[model samples]
Target: MKSWPRPEVPTITTADFQLRLFDTADQVIKPVHMPATGPVGMYVCGITPYDATHLGHGATYLAFDLIHRLLLATGRDVTFVQNITDVDDPLFERAERDNVDWRHLGTSQIDLFRSDMENLRVIPPQHYIGVQESIDDVIDVVQQLLDNGAAYIVDDPAHPDIYARRDATPQFGYESNYDEQTMAEFFAERGGDPTRPGKHDPLDALIWKARREGEPWWDSPFGQGRPGWHIECAAIARRFLGSTFAIQGGGSDLIFPHHEYSAAHIEAACNEPRMAGHYVHTGMISLDGVKMSKSLGNLVFVSKLTEQGARPSAIRLAVYASHYRQNRDFSTAVLAQAESRLDTWMQAVRRADDDSAARTLIDTVIKHLAEDLDTPGAIAAVDSWAAGIVGAKDASNASTELTGPGALVAQALDALMGITL
Candidate 1:
């Protein structure tokens, strides 16, 4: 699947800054290493496509978008690959409930997701692959695990299921440092079944699920069934990004079984200890006070906000108001504040006085962003600069051409934060 078009990011001369990120495993912020001049691999777990794009989804994708933008601005060729979980159980259940063909439902939701990403100016992945298109690759990985004694088959009623042995990899529980009880709880809460009786270990993740009476199936040596949740990402990442990549990122919700199982699967199959050099995750978002989830039917969608005449840049600002690692609430007041900020920035850019403060603001924003993607700090820097500029000058310029120091800041904002004013 092709991604949406790249946004019109302005070209700006930016000094190279050391990008730092908080690794979930280490529980500390550290500087990331980049090659001198080569491709940087990143795989962000995409949406399942059973529902619309919500603020939580927007926040998650935009977190990685910042990383992508900074990598590009610092002169690194990025090979970003994000996968759409089109063949997941949520999509199937939603399709069955709505009485729509699953394929048609998945396609429609994916189209809507693409539209949302475009409106938000998200940098699309170079390889936006779907599970349906990578069935062969999934089978190959499963077969590899089975061949390497890392996977086993469970005899079920009509067909046998494939599962990855939890003990096969030594670094199984290193993804999230949660204890067994907490891990099990998150597993059961986030689309995992720990009580299933047929597995060797309760924590053992499914690699392939045998076809049920009304589910989809593909021809594979293990059974006539579809790929499991963990295997899809591992297979796709390996296929597109070789054995190891620079970063494996997703929401903090996926830190448990999803990331752990995905990493373990690759380790078992490829005979490598680690799959990604850095494990980065975004924070959860809330609607008012409640967490935004599909089951609750309380989602603030991106499309809905855009349809209601919200500025796309304002929406970006609203999401960026808080740091990417900090969970925050989205309310009408939040959007209003972001809109006001956007207006001030636009006004500041059109001021008559060409002050040296603009250059300082550019470096300040880059420094804040490099320090663990400190968006709130960067926004605060811009806010202070804008206040100083707008307060000192009464007569504003008539020209909107992006050529002055103000224009330099504007272009850097567009190029770095995906926030175009």
Candidate 2:
């Protein structure tokens, strides 16, 4: 793949508010420093566009969108790249069930996904590449891996495919933080055929799969086949962000074989020790104590919520009210609470005064968000500020003091949380 022109990283003038991120590889919270000369590169795993936009999907994307907003607020240029797995097995299966062409299904869902994101005020990535469009690049990376002896052809009579040698890369499970047993369990849950007879190791991941009957196939050096799920991300990231980027983000569920193998493939292809500066994974969303899944039929679709007249800002607030790395339960009660809090903030903003109280509240919120995106803390700070504003208004003639503070609060909400009031 050809190298992309890196954007110049601007000098950040915001207060020395250190941004802390939980690096999955190191398993610790570390301060995130912006690069001096180029844009902060972020690659987030996007949707497959087969299912409805559920709360799980909403939470993941909003988490990254928060990061994107903060980076820009700190006066840094960010080149965000999110990939769409348009040609994956799930999409194909869903298309077959719906009796529609897979490509057409993908296109329709992509449009719907775009609409949902826009409605929620989630900023779009600068580059949104699809797997089907990047076949040549994916194939290039696969061939490179093969030539470097990092990957091998596995020709089982039952399952002919290209597999990445897990042992070949010492850092294969660096980000997963899972033991062998736990890895095996989650790997199976996340689409790993662990018991397949011909794989060199139980953890060996498929890099390329030979075309099967009725499946879409692309001509490549490895013959008529498509890139494996993990390899598609490696290829797309390499094309946009080069060998090493600032951050690689996805849901915690992908921490296992998906992200683990993605890092392995990119490092093997580039001959670099690190694929990304940081690996950040968001927490999962569950309903009634069970993780929401399409198979389980327990999904809370964002489209349905909006269609039923739920405000987009309320949904966003509901997700942002919790820490990004903590599991959240999806329920109407939570959304109602978020809506109430959003309303309180909006009211406070309307009656804001340009006083020390409002400025102090804004500073506190910024500080909380800077420290590992403590959104709950930020919301609390805003809540306290709103309470004080309301109290002051009721006690005395303080309407004159609110105009400046109100405008600042509104600006902060929009700039920091994408909440326009």
Candidate 3:
């Protein structure tokens, strides 16, 4: 197997912020200085496009958007690639329930998701691929795995299936820190058919799912089947970025089967030591105390919030107010607080004039964000800066200090966090 060209890793440094990354591979939070001589390859697992964009989805993407902005702000070019699992089981199930063509359903929902992301000012990825469109690439990967004895075809009465043999890949769960029981639980929750008979191991995931009676199918060397959920990302990322890349990121929920299996499949295909150099995961978003999920029937859609006259900026702020790695509860109170904080920041930006103070605030924000994307701390610092500016304005120094610091803070917010004031 020939290895693809790898991007040159450069040394990155922020003026006042020391950027640190929490490497899931090593279970350590350490300073990251990998600057990009070329574009930094970033692959984020995207939505399945089966349902509306919810708060959980918002938080995950916003978390990565923050990282994307921070990288750009610190002078690193990024080639971001996010894959849409348009051919997944949930999408087909939803389409069947809605009595609509699966393709049409996916297309409409993806449009809605794109609208929501755009409204929130989230940067679009350089390559946004769909599984159906990348069938060739996926098929090629599966063939490689088969040839290398990393994958095998399982005969099923209904359909022929190809599974990635977990036993063949020693690094199957390298990215996941969960124990066997916990991993099994999450694996089942996230579409892993763990107990399915004939797999080399219960954890072995499907690479190519044989054609069913009604589901979409593609012509492949294996048979008339569709690519599995995990294989699509590995294929697409490899196609766009190469065998090894800078980072692979998604919601923490994907750390188990999705990310873990994807990494295994990629490594198996390329015969490489690593797929992604770093794995970054964002925390889950819970509603009240329970995790907000479509399965739980407790979803706060982005469309609903926008329809209720809530600003997209406020929604983004609500998600950004908490650390990306910490699970946050969604509530009306949280949204209200975010709106209020955004208002305060906007007012301060309008009145800020102290360049020295503005520089100081920028440095403080950078420091907070650079430390493993500590958004809450960074936001707190900004709130404090805004409060002080407001106090100074009330004390009659408003005319001179307001504009400078205000503008600087606004720019910093936009640059560091994608929060436009």
Candidate 4:
């Protein structure tokens, strides 16, 4: 469960900014919190580690990295936690297909993921948990759900299953705000066995899956079965973040059964009203106009890109060109544009010239980022500043420029944007 090394973020003096995010429930960008008494808690879902990290994965983590940076710059103590669903069906299925050991596959993929994050200069989470390490904790949560009458056990002759009850959690459907029909559609699409024989409503999600032959299992009162997809996140978040946290974020794809059910389970077990202050989702990354995914084998691996003469900094810049909420396409053309932008930025910074506009550039990046993590706008502002600096140097005599602009520009990018240039 150890995390990758974190990049050293520069400390800026300005802290007068309001942080806002697009809350999925409210369907609007709003202030996530005011100055509060406790350290801010954030729980972002981590990867299942069945394959290498792709551009879609890169985009999501980098989006959260921006949020993490601004929150620290704004004088908030943040406790961030993320989980690895290493015991999920995907890993088992992939392992079987590849004719390899499941544990070895998970470990190898996790190592690659850590390498990708470290190469990208991302700030690693404080608590990076794996399901195998937290089996006891997950068991306790399932037990509590069953004892509270919030979940029911289904008698499957081969393996018993536990499902969440819609009647126990008053806010079951509020997070997604979908009609029952729509919820069922999404549920069936995203790993939910809606038509499975069970006592509760069709929408009830699986929290415990009884042991099947050759699958991982843990001993509990419920049965010798692994934790379900949704409940693993619920238990992990509760153990580290308590009942409520500031943000629960992942890809937009998880807005359905995954996040909705996780929120319901926690609300029932902890007797709390909600899971977090805000539920945020990042945009998807696509290729040739098709969304990149593991199943489709259409993934653009970050490791492959970096290995094939692509700068990690340029990759970060490419992602910065699009807002986190908008779907973006990945191609060599996009990478070329980003590399060109990075070249201009490095040229400007290398000059180390004195431009009075450095402080203005810093303030602009901070303000734009504070408002919905506006990465594209922030990158644009930087691009303009770099252009002005380069133009002025070319047009003017070799005059003695101020030192403050160069230092501040370099420091601001590293601090506010996690870009070393």
Tens-place lDDT per residue, model 2, 1-421, is 1112322222222464667788998998887757888899999998898874888999998888888878887777899998999888899889999999999998888887887887888878889899878998999999998999988888675456998888877766777778889888987888787887788888788888888999988887777888889999999999999999889999998888889888889998888888888899999998877889888999998999999988988998899888999998878888899889887777777777656776777778888888888999998888888887666675344343335768777676677777766
List TM-scores for all candidates, in order.
0.97, 0.93, 0.92, 0.96
TM-score pick, better of 1 and 2: 1
lDDT of 3 at 123: 79
Each model's lDDT: 0.88, 0.83, 0.82, 0.87
Give the Cα error of residue 60 in candidate 2, in Å: 0.7
Cα shift from native, residue 182, model 4 (Å): 2.2
Candidate with more favorable, higher lDDT: 3 or 4:
4
Error of 4 at 28 (Å): 1.0
Candidate 3: where is the Cα deviation over 4 Å?
1-18, 33-36, 395-403
Q: Which residue runs does candidate 4 get wrong by more than 4 Å?
A: 352-355, 395-403
Q: Which candidate is the best by lDDT?
A: 1
Q: What TM-score should be assigned to candidate 4?
A: 0.96
By TM-score, the best candidate is: 1
Residues 1-421 of candidate 1 have per-residue lDDT tens digits of 8889987877778777888898887788887767555799999999888776888888899899999999888878899999999898989899989999999998888999999999999989999999999999999999999999999887667667888898999878887878889888988988787777678888888889998888888988766899999999999999999888889999999998899889999989999988887899988998887898877988999999999989989999999999898888899999999999998898888772564778778899999999899999999999998888777877544356656777787888999998876
Candidate 1 pairs with clashing backbones: none
The candidate with the higher TM-score, 1 or 4, is 1
